[model samples]
Target: MEVVQVLCMKGGNGDTSYAQNSLLQKKVISLTKPITDEAISNLFCNNFPARLCIADLGCSSGPNTLFAVLEFVTTVDKVHKKMGHELPEIQVFLNDLPGNDFNTIFKSLPTFQKDLQKTMGAGAESCFVTGVPGSFYGRLFLGKSLHFVHSSYSLQWLSQVPRGLESNKGNIYMASSSPPSVLKAYYEQFQTDFSMFLRCRSEELLEGGSMVLTFLGRISEDPSSKECCYIWELLAVALNDMVAEGLVEEEKMDSFNIPQYTPSPAEVKCEVEKEGSFTINRLEASEVNWNAYHEEVFSRYQKIVADRMSREKTEFVNVTVSMTKRG
Candidate 1:
């Protein structure tokens, strides 16, 4: 099956305010640290080699990716320092969709390298950071190569928008109410994409490697209620307004759907268990209200809410960390 390369045109034009919301950044880094530390510590303690290979799947083009990579490496360096051992050389592979704005990522690398040198000192250790564009559902590295994998805010997107929406069966993703058929299609796509993810990673990760994943998720099983994400509602309203203004075609609005699948925490755990290769180490869920007023190009179409209660109350993104010990 061909994978749909996940692309976000919304942030490609250099309007990074939406992508760099302070609350969103704090929540993402807070949720990721424990998992990242665990994975790095496990890999280092295993005594695999003098060099470590770590990858961030679905790493979009921005300073956020650079921040995350540096955070992980800094943690690893600290661990090595505590052990009274020389810091190991690290190679960070940044993987994203083929259509990603690699120019932006590449332009920021030199600055990152300088920051690394200033913080860790020139003689501490060497670290290589490079971008590799591709779908995560395929092999991006050699077998038994990677020691750790990390992804955030990117797993909820399916390989593609679900097929067969025109048959009147149902739409796969809904802004408000969802039909049973739509729910079924969403679940099936998740299962397929997630299974392919496991199969691909199983080959790329070494026997004692680890992976950390975080994404938007639903806390309830009800298909009709607003339990998933508020961004969907906001986007739906924006699309509707555009359609009414003739800025976008009506049929295109009907056919156009955001590629998303907000699986429940239990459902995610079940799928991971069934894969049988990775063992869950920790899972946690939290919510963050990522709304701030910014007089930027992207924040021009702002909506005023009466209170926090009206901003669509849904569970925060879910984070899961897992490990695989080569059997």
Candidate 2:
């Protein structure tokens, strides 16, 4: 399936919407907060821009959206306050696929502005937030425009499904049942997409600029390692369960695969080096247990999954693929 056509965090603020079901993503943002803080702090202390431009790529809508923006703005505000200098005009660019539910974020802006005003007080007035709807795999901003870039639980998503997997057999996304060729396709797609990511950012970021990214990654070189890819296995199980009931075509199941891949830190480093744009100042890997989710939220999520499969099988695949990546 075409990723841009299908890839979206379930929209709106309803139960199945990414807004309601994104606690795991919030945790990722939180887990990476200090790193985020340091990146921004380094930007300011080393050579602070008069007008700071920051982009939150794949910034799906909901609380997590502004939550990241809040952390970024707060980092700059605190650094400026400590330095006793005028705060820079912070331009916050929120990015995601065009299908993302920007309306919720837009509606939340009034409150966000108010909260920022309340939190940062006078300095908050300098921060300007705008939404840019597009893919981050390609150029999204002007040359040397952004200072600090943040993307959490995203980047795992490939720009599209891998090529030449028409007969991958009964599996979806880096599963043990997948053959070596299938796994290779996933890795190649990641290498391409990630190289593009670093390449594009290299152009957009100023010298001495930095980026803090957190996404699902494997501790093992093996693609079938549970840490690397159990969620998709479970999702395939869920869909196969539906197939047992004749709700979906087996052919659909065979053809359908998630447009996402998790890389090991070594793989990430290799691609970053191969791209030869940005230096790897740091690389850290963390894991979140699959059972960390509350049962109530998961039940709602499962219902949405079944509904999406019934409505548009690949649509369910697309959204839940994103959800599991975040988790």
Best by lDDT: 2
Each model's C-alpha lDDT? 0.70, 0.77
Candidate 1 per-residue C-alpha lDDT over 1-327 given as tens digits, one digit per residue, 9 for 90 to 100: 334544652344344433454347546767668777877787767474688888998877667878888888888788888887787788999988877777777888889888787778862348888788788877889998888998887888888887755532122255445556666776788889887888788888888788888867766665334656455555555556666777767777677666678777787788888888787777766555555343321242355322434644534556455566455
TM-scores for every candidate against the unseen true structure: 0.86, 0.88
Per model, state how many residue pairs clash: 0, 0
Where model 2 places Cα greater than 4 Å from the true spot, the runs are: 291-327
Q: Give the top-scoring candidate (TM-score).
A: 2
Return the clash pairs for model 2, or none: none
After the best TM-score superposition of candidate 2, give how far the Cα of residue 187 lies from its true spot, in angstroms: 0.5
